[model samples]
Target: MALRLLLDSADPSAWAEWLPTGLFRGVTTNPTLLRRAAQPCNLEHLAELTARALELGAEELHLQAWGADLLGCGRALAQLAPGRIWVKLPITRAGAAAARALIAEGCPVTFTACYEPAQVLLAVALGADYIAPYLGRISDLGRDGHANLTRMQRIVESVRRVDPDGPGDRPDASPPLRLLVASLRSPNDLALLAAEGLDTFTISPDIATALFAVEPTLAAAAQFERDAEDT
Candidate 1:
């Protein structure tokens, strides 16, 4: 599968602006991003935020269900649109139970806050649809983020071998469990991770912008266009 880029933002306006570019597949947001984006973090607004995501052409929506509302958020998301909203749950014991409950109720999950490859194994065991490891944060903790990141493919394959009923099983029937990485330092990190064969990324808007913006490359394109016009 091709690499899928998702914008990490809480503001619906950002989704409206960026999803139209055809590069972003969706938006991944939690209450923290909402606070940063200056939007109200309330339960009443959940449906509206989700609807806004879909109206703006986002094919997928990753919403965080934290602080005693994992099941509540799953129920709320189910009311919005089917199969598009993947609730973000931390990989705690509660989170694992909540994920299983939510999946039983038809809500998929993205297990977040992973820092190690072993954590990835546990998430797969819980039947998470996606696992998001914080690359920059892992590096901040002085861990070998690249080693963990590069090991994801091998880890995932190993998990699938042991559990055929797990996510990523029977590729013809279902899309594999995706490793949706986040908190990358820059566009350069995105490039390196992509080179490592990581297929999905949830990046900040600045990194997303930088990914397409190269002054030297744009200048060359401009010169080529000018010469063609003159010719």
Candidate 2:
């Protein structure tokens, strides 16, 4: 599959800045991001936020469910934009239960906070739409984050071979569980992880900006403009 990028932020300003670029497939948000953006965690605020994201050209929105009643929150988030919303749940027992129920009800689910390779099995078995692993956070724990993420991607690819209509093979079939890697620290991490065969990513605005900050590239663009102006 081709590389898919999602803007990881609750701030509409970020969405407005990047979404219109047509590079990001969507936007991903959790309670912490909402808090960081000074947005309320309640459904009322999320409804407004979702509308704003869509207005800014976000094709999809991954809204995370919080608190004890994950299923309830997932259901509400799913209703926000119907096919456009993908409810995010933690990859825990409770989250699995919630994801199972949500998936059963036809709500696309993304299992989040995935720290171990074994957790990918849960997402696969449950037929989730996506599983997110925090790469930089894993590295912060003194583990080899790139190696662990590659293992997770391998598990995701291995599952595709079992079914005739699995990920990256059939376009009309049910979507397979995708490894949406998150918590990227630098622009270089994109190339590093992509080299490991990982595709989907959720990046912060700073990283997004850095992706276009190469000095040589900027100089080339300036020279092109100067040539055009000279003509």
Candidate 3:
């Protein structure tokens, strides 16, 4: 499972459509995605969504904590499924504080909204299970998102070498702190980033749809069906 993929969406409809395909390892969501899906950002709603995702075979569900009490929200979110839930927090001071507390409790934490290369250091220090960097958003900021992400990957590997006992170690130990790339605008981003050794990604449903929409593949599949019917 070097190349891991997760559905980056909040809509249950999206989960119902894609999760059964088994193309996605899990799903990731945030406050913005929740609003876009017309869902309230609260523990009650999140709990329901978590149940649905897990029921649909989501091995991991990332739910971002929100509002003033980040720590409180994070704590509650982690309780949704314990080992299966990965509480997402932004790469800010306050978010870091909440993340640190959550990490100490052995909660799976993922640092989201990452833009800079140095932020990987913080994630490594906190022993987060994942750090999500928005690729398209970085490019929107007029920077080379691909290059920035490459650097983040390097830093993660470098730290792993320094501290072999760190995240993503032996199977019996804790899970690795993978770089979960997000905000992908196109399917090609996956290939480009994966080529750079960034294996984990969370793509929107649109991108997931696009991945299966290759004209040649569709034509071949149609031909195969026709041939089978004729025979």
Candidate 4:
């Protein structure tokens, strides 16, 4: 499968125009993003945004829950988009319990705010659909971000070998839960994670534009055009 590209935008109004550009595979929003949009973080607004994403052909919609009230959040999520939504919760015990419950009930859950490989292992144990690690946040704190992701990948593989029916179960031989690297600061960050075989990466439009703006890339394209004309 192609590496999924999700746009982490705060404004819904911006998405209506941006979705047509064909770069984004999905959209992810948090309470902060909604606050930036000048909207309340309620179920109604979330459902509306989810519907808009669906209309824009987004394959997934990531919605976050801020506190320890996972049951309430899960209920609210069920009401707002149901199967189409991936409820994002922190990588805490409460979050894991809620994620397990939701996933058992067939609701996709994304375990967010992950920092360590242990957190990712817990997410897999809870049958999470996605585990989001903040690469930039980790790197900012003087940690080797890619090393952590690599460690998590190894843990996943080991789990699969020990007990195939355990946290790393491959029901149809599919890989374990996807690792979605978050908190991207630049297009280079996305490229770094993509090269590491990450399942997905969320980026801002500014960074997304930068991915195709490297001077060497432009020069190579220009050289190709000149060579074609000569031929």
Residue-by-residue lDDT tens digits, candidate 4, 1-231: 367778887577667756777778778888987887796788777777888888887777888876668867876876577677788888887887787787777788888888988887787677787888888889888999877777776776677678857654555632467788788888777666667666577887777778779999999999999999999
Q: What is the lDDT of candidate 3?
A: 0.92
Q: Highest lDDT among the candidates is held by which one? A: 3
lDDT of 1 by residue, 153-190 (tens): 67887767887776666665345677899998888888
Q: What's the ranking of the predictions by lDDT, best on top?
A: 3, 2, 1, 4
- Clash pairs, candidate 2, are none
Model 2 ranges off by over 4 Å: 163-173, 229-231
Deviation (Å) of 102 in candidate 4: 1.3
Give the winner by lDDT: 3 or 4: 3
87, model 3: CA deviation in Å?
Answer: 0.6
| Weakest 10 consecutive residues of candidate 1 by summed lDDT | 167-176
Against the true structure, candidate 4 has what lDDT?
0.78
User: On TM-score, who's better, 2 or 4?
Assistant: 2
lDDT of 2 at 107: 89
**Strongest candidate by TM-score:** 3
Q: Report the C-alpha displacement of residue 159, candidate 4, in angstroms.
A: 2.3
Any residue pairs clashing in model 3, and if so which?
A: 168-176
